[model samples]
Target chain A: MKSEYLSEYDNIVRTMQLYIDGCKQGKSELMRPAFHPNASFFGYAGEQLAIGTQFLFDWIDKNGPAPNIEPRIVSVDILDSIAVVRLEVAEWSGKLAGSGVRMSDLFTLLKTPGGWKIIQKAFHWHAAEQRLAA
Target chain B: MPERNTPQKTLESWKQIAAYLDRSERTVRRWEATEGLPVHRHEHERQDTVFAYRHEIEAWSRLRTASPNPSSVDGADTDNLPAPTPIVNKYLVEHDAITRTMHRYIAGARAGDSDLMRSAFHPSATISGYCLGVEYTGSVEHVFQWIDENGPAPNINPRFARIEIIESIAVVHLEVQHWSGKLAGANARASDVFTLLKRNGEWKITHKLFHWHDQ
Candidate 1:
C-alpha cells in the first residue's frame, strides 16, 4: 500500500517538472499535460490584481522558448489527490532586468486519470532585499 | 404492533423536515442535492412524497458537528476513486478552519491580544502598508506589539471580501473599517490581502499587504 502511494507521489513530481519545463520552453503544449484546462492564476501586477491563466500564458509567450529565467521547486505537500507546490524563479533578463522582482508561485494540483494537473496558482512577488530570509 | 404515527419519530413532509432543521425548505432541498443530506423519497408508495427518519437526521447532525478537521479522518476513505461529495465535504471542513482563524485575527485586533494575533501568523510573516500616508513595513510580531502599545481601536470591523483556498494554501481579502486608534477622527478603510499556508497541520499567515483609504 505504501509503495502504491510512493509511485503516485513520483508521478505527481514528474507532472510538475513537465509544467516547469513547459514554462521555460514557452511551449504551452508542454505545460498542457500539467493543467486541468480550467486552471487559473491570481496575483498582483504592481498595484492591480492580475487574474486567469491568460496572464501567465501571455507572459510565457512574450518571453520564453530559449529562456534566461531559472525555476526551482522549493517544496511539495500532498494529501490524498490534492497537493500544493511552492516554486521559486530567478535569473531574470531583458525587460525584467534590474527590476529586482523575486517571484514565488504556489500551485494547487489534483491527481486525475491523466496524472497530476495544476488547478490554481497564487503568486508572491517581493523585492530582492525582502526575499523571505527563511 | 408498531405505532402508525410513531410519536415524533419521523418527518413525512418537506415542510416538517425544514422546520425540524430550522432551515427554509429551499435550503434543505439544496443541502440534500449538494451535501448528501439524508432525505429519502417515498418509492414504494408514490415517489412524490419525501420522508426523513428522525434517527438518520440526528446521526448525520452528529457527524457534521463531530469533525471539523479533515486530516483527522481515516486515510483509507480516500484511497479509492475520489468522490465529489467527500472531497467537497473535506474542503468545506478545512475552509471553516480558515474562517475561524480569520475571526481570531479580528478578535485579536479588537482587543490587542498580541499572543492571539501571533498565533494566526508565521513567525517570519511580514506586514506592509501606508499608515497616515507613510509607508511602513515590518514583521507580524512587530504589528502585534504595536497594537499592544497603542491600545485597541475603538471600532475595527473586518468583512471578508474574498477567500480562495487551493489545497494547503489560501488567500484572503479583508475589507476593514477602523476608527479611533492612531487616527481617531479620520476613520480609515483598508483593503488587506493575506497569504496563508497550512504547515504541520496548522494554518498561518505568511504575508500581509494592504492599501489604506482615509474616509
Candidate 2:
C-alpha cells in the first residue's frame, strides 16, 4: 500500500474499533462517533428485515454486554473519499444464555469534513448452527 | 435560451416535438422529466400545451449523447456524435474499466481458476463471509484456495444488481444462483458486495463480503 493509504487505513480501523468497543460494552453512545448523524442500517433479524440506525441502537441497549464477543476486521477498501469495511463478529451472546450469534457486517463510509463516518451498514445474522460450529 | 444561427421553428404539442426528435411521445415525455428536455408550456383557460424550439431540442440531444452512459439512450443515432467533455470522458473511462474488472472476477469463478481472478484484485485484497453456516475470513488467497479445491462452477449464474461509483471508489452488488462447490448438489444462492478502488489508473477489487442464503 502507498504511504498515504496506510494512514487512511489506520484511521478507518480506528473508527471501526469504536463500533466494536460499543458492541462489547453494549452502549450505543460509544458507537455514535463512528457513524454519521443520518447513517442507516439494513439487515435480517431472523426472517424480518431490520431497518434504520435507531433500531440498531435500541437493539444494542436491549442486548446488554457480550464481553466474550470477538470481532475481526476482514477487509478495508478505500478509494479517494469513500471506503468500505467488512467485519465479522462471533460469540455474541443472545437473550438466552449459551445461545451465541454470529454476524457479518458491511459498512460504507465517507470522508466527511469532520472525519471518516459510517454512512450505511448492511449485515447478515448467520444461522445458529454456524455459530455453534464457530 | 435560444441559440443564434439555428432554425427557429417552433414544435407545437408533445406529438410535434416527438416527431421532430424521431421518438415516441412517451419517450420524449420521459426525457423531459428525467433528462431536462427543453419544453415551454402555455397556460390557457381550457388546457395547457407544451412547445419546444428546434435548436434547443437539437442542443439537448447533443448534450445527452455526450453524457457518461449514452448507450442508455434508446435508439440513439450513432452518426455525427459530439465528443464528450474531459470530465465526462474521465467518468466513462473509469466506469468501463471497473466493469471489465468485475467481468474478470466472474470469469475466474466460472472456470475455477484463481490465476484468472488474481488480476482483478489488489495484492492486499481480503474476502470475508459465511457459507453453509461456516465463517470464512482472511486474505483473498483463501478464496482462491477454496475455488481450486472445489473445482469449476460453470453452471453458476451471476446477476449484477448494482454498481455505484463515486470518483475513484465503487461498490458492486451481485447475486448468484446455482453456485457449484461444496453446496453443488443443492441449489445454493449468494449475495455479494464488492468494494473497489482505482490505483495508478487501474481499478481492482479490494474487498468482498458475501452472504449465502439458507437452504
Candidate 3:
C-alpha cells in the first residue's frame, strides 16, 4: 500500500477500534466519534429488522459489557472517499452466561469533512443452529 | 395562505418523479399510461426525455385518489407547459449504473459465460467462498473458470436482497436459487455478497463472498 493509503488504513482501523471498545465497555459515548451524526443502521435482531443507530447505542447500554467477546476484522476495502469493512464478532455474552451471541457486521464509512465516520452499519446475528452447523 | 416566492419545482426524470410521489418508476410510468398523469415529454427527443411539475403531479394524485372518475389530462397542450429545469440527481443515476452492472453479472451467470461475467468485475477483483462444503479462496479467475466448467444455469432465480451505497463504495446482498453447478442434479441455493467500487466513472465488483446452502 502507498503511504497515503497506509495513513488512511490506520485511520479507518482507529475509527473501528472506537466502536469495538465501546462494545467492550458498554458505553455509547466511546463509540460516538466513530459514527457520522446522521449515520443509519440496518440489520436483523432475531427475526426483527433493527433500524437506526440509536437502537445500537441503546442495546450497547442495556447489554452492559462484553469483555470476553472476540472481534475479528475480516476485510477492509477502500476506494477514493468511501470504504467497507467486514467484521466477525463471536462469544458476545448476552443476558445468560455462555449465551454466546455471534454476529457478522458490514460497515460503510465515508471520508467526510470531519474525517472518516461510519455512515451505515448492516449486520446479521448468527443463530445457534447456523453456528453449530458452521 | 399567500403564494410563496419559490419557483415551481420540476422533476427531471422518471426516477425523481417516482421519488417525489413515493412510488416505483414502473408504477409511475404505468400511471402516466393509464391514469393520465401530467407528464410532459421533450419534443424531438427520446421517450425518456420527460419532466413534470410537482404541483401538477400533486393535483393529479389528489383527483385520482379522491374522485370516482378522474378526468383525463393526456391531450393537454405541451406548448403551454413551462420549460423544464433539469434536476440531474447524481445519486439516482449512479444507482441505475450500479444496477446495470449487477444485471450484467446475472446475465453472465444465466448463460454461463465467463467473458460476460468478467466485464462486471475489476481486473484485481478476488472471490472467496465455500463450494460443496469445501473452502475456496483465490482470484476471481477461479470463479470464472468454475462457471465455464459448470455450464449455464438458465433456470436460476436471482434476487437483489439489499444494495447499500455510500458515495463511491457499495455492498450488494444477492440471493440465488436453483444455481446448478458441479452437484449433478441437485440444484443449489447461494447467498452472495459483492463489494463494488466506482473507478474511472464505472462501477465494478471488487470482491465477492458467498455461501452455498445445503442441497
- TM-scores for every predicted model: 0.42, 0.41, 0.42
Give the top-scoring candidate (lDDT): 2
Stretches > 4 Å off in candidate 1: A1-134, B1-88, B183-186
TM-score of chain A of each: 0.79, 0.89, 0.90
- What lDDT score goes with residue B55 in model 2? 77
Better of 1 and 3 by lDDT: 3
Q: What is the DockQ score of candidate 2, to 2 decimals? A: 0.03
Model 3: CA > 4 A from native:
A96-98, A128-134, B1-170, B173-215
Candidate 2 collision pairs: none
lDDT score of residue A8 within candidate 2: 90
lDDT scores in order:
0.62, 0.69, 0.69
* Deviation of model 3 at A122, angstroms: 0.2
Give the Cα error of residue A31 in candidate 1, in Å.
Answer: 21
> Which lDDT tens digits does candidate 3 get at residues B78-145?
11223334336677557756766777677667667776577788776766555665655557898888
Model 3 TM-score on a 0 to 1 scale: 0.42
Which of candidates 1 and 2 reaches a greater TM-score?
1
lDDT of 2 by residue, B1-215 (tens): 22333365888888888767666686776455434567665645334467888877766665554434342345553223355334456676676567667766776776677766787887767666556656555578987887777667756657777776654456787787767765344456777777776666777787676776777
Checking candidate 1 for backbone clashes, the offending pairs are none
